[model samples]
Target: MAVSSLSLSLVPRTFKDKLNEPRWSESPRASELPLHHAIACSCDRTTGFDEEISGNCKRRPLLLGVVGSLTASLLPASSLLAQEMPANYRAFVDLSDGYSYYYPSDWREFDFRGHDSAFKDRYLQLQNVRVRFIPTDKKDIHDMGPMDEVVSNLVKNIYATPNQIANIFDTQERTVDGRDYYTFEYELRSPNFASCSFATIAVANGRFYTLTVAANERRWRRVRNKLKVVADSFKVLDI
Candidate 1:
């Protein structure tokens, strides 16, 4: 018999720093620095235990209904989907939340307030993926209403903050396992900095789920495809 090896590497912080501080405050919410951990392992097929980027080899559990208002300028954004998970990406499943998605292998876990699960770039705090969910009576994402109206309202009014300008560039729809999902692209610009993101939403298992992956506007063109992988991978599983 052969055994697989797994390891976790924690980035160090100063003694004066609180263990879980929200670094990105300009946005609506904050980030709890779980001191992002690097993990190397696979989900145990037999046990069904999903991998969390932590010191342990495996752990259980971890949503967004939208993200911070996305309006850099509503350009003609295209719907980009990945047919298959890439070699560089890893699956993140939250059995507790009844949702799962794929993230980049190098990204690590961070405690983002009000989110079910979140991962960020080791070097760039601004680049990340986050999930959030809330109980709902609605059975499908389409229940929220027309895709354009829902996305426009979400980005402009819900996700964007007081200081940011938001806009929607594109919107798309998909059905998986008979469940409908709404996916969209948007950007947010503040006086100081700007960011763009892909957001996917669905309703299932009595919950409304949202997943968003983002990168700084300056690097959006270079990393958008990779982030789209995370966005397209969002799926809801039966409880």
Candidate 2:
């Protein structure tokens, strides 16, 4: 499996540094494959985290499709990712890989070896979202097989380590722009830690894209809905 890369234009850590920075800066990571950058808003215009994410995701085209695609069944009127998103979630767009997803404005980029792009909580690293893609000959996610069986095999055999316990809670399939996508919920528990997560996968532009958003088991309930928005928002764009 040959994986591709992802990138996002991250904001500087300090308020003073933000004031002097450009609106759309390049990703700081180095990669052999081409990487894309997010279209960011001017940092000085925001007063708090809420406004930052709202402004960033709303103004960027990368997220317009995401917000537009949330069906009524997926999001009730009161859902945060409904017609109007909360001010704390921003979009991370990879123009090159042709995929995008939302994440908390407070999270910072980190190197999660094997993943093209990732972001984690400043204090709790386990609460994070990451995306990676690999070349594939298959034309659609359905090419893998039935949703339940395929998801189970991937989680139990590929995603989880031999020593970890993997339990899949649910699996779903959706179609957007004539493309098929499979999203699932699962738990991976090891001797040291346990985490619950939602994963979305799709095959497009000759690549298999996977985006996972997770949180520690203890924090799952509190952050599940927010992370669900991230997982559902994963979009594979036309490259």
Candidate 3:
């Protein structure tokens, strides 16, 4: 918790910095986990294909604050985990749209989302939420309504305020081995994207799936120690 030299001059010296860490000029894969160099662990808010995950797990700052306090238990009416994420962090190549799951890698499969999707179909391509900002809006974000209600209506409509933006915390159901799914977690601190916000989750493909980790408020208190090794390295596989 010692980064503030004005956020270390807002980080980035050579990786052409502007906040999109992890990515060492390519050429490092076997299903990923070593291209760090700076931005620790990001898959936005991952965890889905857990074969007891690997990447040698061993990052302990109180286990990254118990995985960012279990991402407010996936948003059970908001508790918000303003930072704490890193457990030797791991996850790569997990994509399934069956009932909830994601963990990009395959070099992010040409990362595409859409509002227009051209000019190399959007840049900020670090893959796995840090820079998948993707705002051309209007259709084919998977045609909306179902990635946990487009991440709970974008945090209950652009970062909460109507009674702390609640409702839809998988009362819509979410499960594993027994199947059934649909999950969501959320938190915010506005300036509407400049004041920095984080703690988001969505799990769908059955009912739903969404997770976020925006950053600010001092890197969300130094990256909330690593949001429970990125939320228990989530899983929903079938692919």
Error in Å for residue 213 of model 1? 0.5
Q: Which pairs in model 2 have colliding backbones?
A: none
TM-score of each: 0.66, 0.66, 0.24
Give RMSD to native, each candidate: 17.2, 13.0, 18.9
Q: Which stretches of candidate 1 lie over 4 Å from their true place?
A: 1-83
Give per-residue CA lDDT, model 1, range 78-110, as digits (tens): 011123546676666544346768788788777
- The Cα RMSD in angstroms, rounded to one decimal, for candidate 1 relative to the true structure is 17.2
**Whole-model lDDT, candidate 3?**
0.29
Whole-model lDDT values for every prediction? 0.61, 0.62, 0.29
Error at 220, model 3, angstroms: 2.4
- Residue 83 local lDDT, model 1: 36
Determine which window of 10 residues in candidate 1 has minimal summed lDDT: 71-80
